[model samples]
Target: MKIELSGDTFYPVGALENFLPQIGRVVELGDLPIAVFRTSDGRIFAALNQNPHPKGGPLAEGIVSGHYLYDPLYDWKIDLTTGLVQAPDTGRVTMFPVKVEEGQVFIAAAVLQQA
Candidate 1:
């Protein structure tokens, strides 16, 4: 399903309950690969599936702790909410706005245009 808000389009990825807590799953947004994560506390987040490190890795395979994702390849800490690599690391992943409604998960299309 698709929802339009203020000219931004939100595309539904899946049901919120389908996502396991602390586990990341890759979903395709057009041609873009997005890493969708549900935190232990039930918060949902979405970001580009590619890690920001020079030696790239799959973000979906990374470990999620709280709101941070530890890169599977280099163990770099990345904030799932802001996409910022924590201090001592330098790089940023592209994050997409996520919304949960009626048990459904949606990701914004605006961020995809910027990516």
Candidate 2:
């Protein structure tokens, strides 16, 4: 379900603690599935759960290293910050804006619409 909060129209997914550093969590925004992550440096990111590779895989289940998410299904390294597939591959993953307010995590509804 989609909930609007402000012009930013962020939908509450969960609390900051819902995500662990170097881990990714799968969350839904409307009908769109997203991979929400928290890096080891206390940074948060959200992206489409599906990998762009022809033989797709679940990105949320991938390994997180720094700002890169290594797709375990095929070992494709993806840049979490930009959603761009790193060297040797030529593809990109869609990314969404994330916000932490009042200890809660929210994703922009606008991004959900785009997805």
Candidate 3:
């Protein structure tokens, strides 16, 4: 399911039902690795697979609690929606827009612009 909107292309990553709640999956857009997460409430979020922390942990391996992801290496709390490293922690991960249509998951090509 590919969608073209105003010159931006949305590439289908996988089926929505395949994204388990509180789990993160890695999808590659060209050379970029994106971490896609699904909350318990069925909301989808996408972010760069790399954590913002100096150690640069793999966000896909992080623990998801609600909309926040706790970095598996540093335990840094990051908001999945905004990619903000919650309080006390500083730095942010790049985030991409995600859309689910008819049970298919799509991630926008805007990430290429960011790259």
Best by TM-score: 1
Per residue, candidate 3 scores C-alpha lDDT tens digits across 1-115 of: 1122234578899999889999999999777788999998899998878877777768998888988998878889998878889989898888777899999999887424432
* Per-model TM-score on C-alpha atoms: 0.89, 0.88, 0.88
lDDT of 1 by residue, 37-98 (tens): 99999999998788878878789988999999988799899988888999999988887888
Q: Write the per-residue lDDT of candidate 2 for residues 6-86, one digit (tens) a residue.
A: 346788999999899998899988887889989999889998788889987789999999999999888899998888999
Model 1: per-residue Cα lDDT at residue 107: 88
User: How far in Å is the alpha carbon of 24 misplaced in model 1?
Assistant: 0.4
Select the stronger candidate by TM-score from 1 and 3: 1
Candidate 3 differs from the real structure by a C-alpha RMSD in angstroms, to one decimal, of 4.9
Model 1, 42: alpha-carbon shift in Å? 0.4
lDDT per model vs. reference: 0.85, 0.84, 0.83
Q: What is the lDDT of candidate 1?
A: 0.85
Model 1 residue 34 distance off true place after TM-score fit, in angstroms: 0.4
Which pairs clash inside model 2? none
